[model samples]
Target: MLRLFAALPLPPEISRPLRKLQKDLVGARWRPEENFHVTLCFFGELRHTQARDLDELLGEIEAPAPTLSLEGAGWFGRREPTAVWARVRESDELRGLASACERAARRLSIPLERRPFTPHVTLAYCHATLLEDARAWTERHQAYSSEPWQAGAFHLYSSQKRDGGPSRYIAEADYPLSGFTAPEGMY
Candidate 1:
């Protein structure tokens, strides 16, 4: 079985600043810089044939690339505070791309969670983080925002789990957007 998802990788200008926010929090397992991405759709573990089908479906999706930016920080799991994240500013283009990913899964008869899409880049997983500490950390970084950049492409990524480390994500296939030309000093 292969663990898979479709996501947009971040450029250095956005990711490098996010790297600086990984400190001053206890019980937080920080995600590596390489793992920083905005997931469009997560298709859990699937048989090889199913995975291949999904990949082919993903490649056929055609849309203009979305311009995205990180704004502020937040956490999930209100009671226990299970994770920390940097919020992505919402855009219709982004949502349309995400919806397209879902439609692909539906066509393949793949079961998926019907959660409302909340665009964000997960920064860390909380093991035993205190609620107060989590709130404070988010408060401190609430005003953060990165320069917006247009995504050139999205990818079908395969994730590999490690025994005592963060899971490694590999981009198995690249799907270029319909109309994307990087502007000066952006990509």
Candidate 2:
């Protein structure tokens, strides 16, 4: 079995600013810069055959890349504060792509969590972080924003855990969107 998800990887231009916001917070395990992404759908653990079928279905999705930006910082778990994240500003195209991911899963007869999609790039996971401390961190970066950038592609990722460390996400497949041109200096 493999843990899989669909997500849009952040370009360097957007990630540079996010890296700056990773300090002065105690009890937070900051995520590595390379792990940052806006998840479209998480399919959790799946059998190898199921994963291959999902990958093929994902490749068949036809949609334009969404233009995205980060607007503000926030935290999940208001009481205990489980994670910190930079909110992704939503657009019609973004929602459509997310919906297409869900539709693909439905066609594969895969069950998904019923939670509504809240797009964000998680900055850290709170480990015994105080509620007050989490609130303060969000307030400090309330005005955080990133310049809009068009995503060239979204990917099917397989996550593997390393002993005593955060999970490493590996892109198993990439599906490029229509009309995307690689920005200069980016591959």
Candidate 3:
């Protein structure tokens, strides 16, 4: 089985700033710069057949690359924060791409979260039961913003444990967006 997800990579223009947001907060597992990505959909632990089907189905989606800007910070849990991340500015393009990915996952019978799309690049995972004043932590980084970057492609990524260490995410395939002009010096 493979843990799979669809995501848009952050270009250096955006990631450079996001990397600096990592902190040594108590019980927090800060994500490395290489791990920063805006997840479109996560379909965890798929059988080999399911993985191939997903790969083939995702290839059918062709849309313009989403334009994105990173800003602010927030956590996911109500009483206890699970993860903290940089916020993504809302755009119809981003929404449309995400919706398409979600639809593909559903068509494959992959269960997915029903939560409304709240796009963010996670910075860290709080390992404790709760982090003191998670709100204050987010507030401190509220003014954060990264240089705007246009995604050239979306990727199918595999999340796996490495040498019994932290989970590592590696791209299995990259799907270029239709009619989406990649910026100069961009991947």
For each candidate, give its TM-score against the true structure.
0.96, 0.96, 0.93
RMSD of 2: 1.2
Q: Residue-wise lDDT of candidate 2 within 106-168, one digit each (tens)? A: 998999999899999999999899999999999999999999999989999999999998999
- Badly placed stretches (over 4 Å) of model 1 are 184-187
**Where does candidate 1 have its weakest 10-residue lDDT segment?**
178-187
In terms of lDDT, the poorest run of 10 residues in model 3 is 127-136
- lDDT by residue (5-40, candidate 3, tens digit) is 999988767877777777746667888888999999
Across residues 51-165, which tens digit of lDDT does each residue of candidate 1 receive? 8999889989998899998999999996999999999999999999999999999999989888789899999999899999999999999999999899999999999999998
Local distance difference test, per candidate?
A: 0.93, 0.93, 0.86
Q: Indicate the TM-score of model 2.
A: 0.96
Residue 125 in model 2: lDDT: 94
Q: What is the lDDT of residue 132 in candidate 3?
A: 64
Give candidate 3's TM-score. Answer: 0.93
Query: What is the C-alpha local distance difference test score of candidate 1?
Result: 0.93
